[model samples]
Target: MPGAPFLRGDRVDLRTVTPEDYDFLLEHGNDPAIRHGAPAPTPVTREDLANFVEDDDESVQFLACHGETPVGFVFLFDVDPWRDHAELGCWIAPNEQGEGYATEAAALCLDHAFGDRGLHKVVARVFEHNDASMAVLDKLGFQQEGRLREQDYVRGQHHDTLLFGLLAEEFEV
Candidate 1:
């Protein structure tokens, strides 16, 4: 079972990731649909996933849970404390995508980022074809700052990656 939440919201709670959650992470990492928007879509092994969970020193990762069941994950990576910014990344399970879990979970992380961490900005990247992620970023008040044309090759074709940013002052609860 997952541990208690580190950040709580109305509908979801963000909990620190644990070894028990490795299977959940592995399942999502290998799902093509889930991996579609990822910059690196290569197949991942259990050992590889374990390494990510263990060796991450520059990122803060959390599991989004609804009543103890993990529904998704949200994280701040590429954190540059000197610059007061970090990159946000998240994914919800296929069956759980339409709900508000992603938004709420991300909001909780943003709260931590801009509030507790005293960050100046948070950025996110999404593939052009990822409408869901775009919507989520939009809801979180991330402005589309720029785009990298044909930056990622997925499923045989190249797709542009949209860069979005949210200033600390621009974020809303």
Candidate 2:
């Protein structure tokens, strides 16, 4: 279990992700607009995404909601307890891309990371072409850490990834 209870913000409420949410996760991740923002553009099969959702091994998967509607999913991976570092990823519905929901949800995640989880750092990777994602990480006080060159090959072309990380000591929260 996560060290704290579910977190919520003005625009979004975050709860533990469940198998029931698998269909939404799979469908949203495959949305054309959403796929374009991600570095990997492969077709996300329902079974594949379900498998991914099934592996919430660290109790880190979160389903973000807008009131009663499911917007999308977010989670942390690559947890190193000794190092207190993990990577976070999130996706909001194409229609819900703006209005600061992403930032709100991300802020809640960071609180869970630093406040409850006792983590020292949380990282995120955004494609160079995704300005909105970069802004959300920036608002959450994450700093650019490094660049992974040609880290992702999608549709016969390679794309770069920008890594951003937030340290507990560095966050204003």
Best by lDDT: 1
Q: What is the alpha-carbon lDDT for the whole of candidate 2?
A: 0.79
Write candidate 1's Cα lDDT for 1-173 as tens digits. 88668998998999988888988987886678888978765888877766666787778888999988999989999888999999999999888889889999999999999999999999999998899999999998999999999998878989999999999999988
Q: Candidate 2: list runs displaced more than 4 Å.
A: 1-5
- TM-score of model 2 relative to the true fold? 0.89
C-alpha-based local distance difference test score of model 1: 0.89
Instruction: Tell me how far the alpha carbon of residue 64 in candidate 1 is from the true structure, in angstroms, after superposition.
Output: 0.3
Clashes of each: 0, 0
Write down the RMSD of candidate 2 (Cα, Å). 3.2
What TM-score does each of the candidates earn? 0.95, 0.89
Model 1 TM-score relative to the real fold: 0.95
Best by TM-score: 1
Candidate 2 weakest lDDT stretch, 10 residues:
1-10
Clashing pairs in 1: none
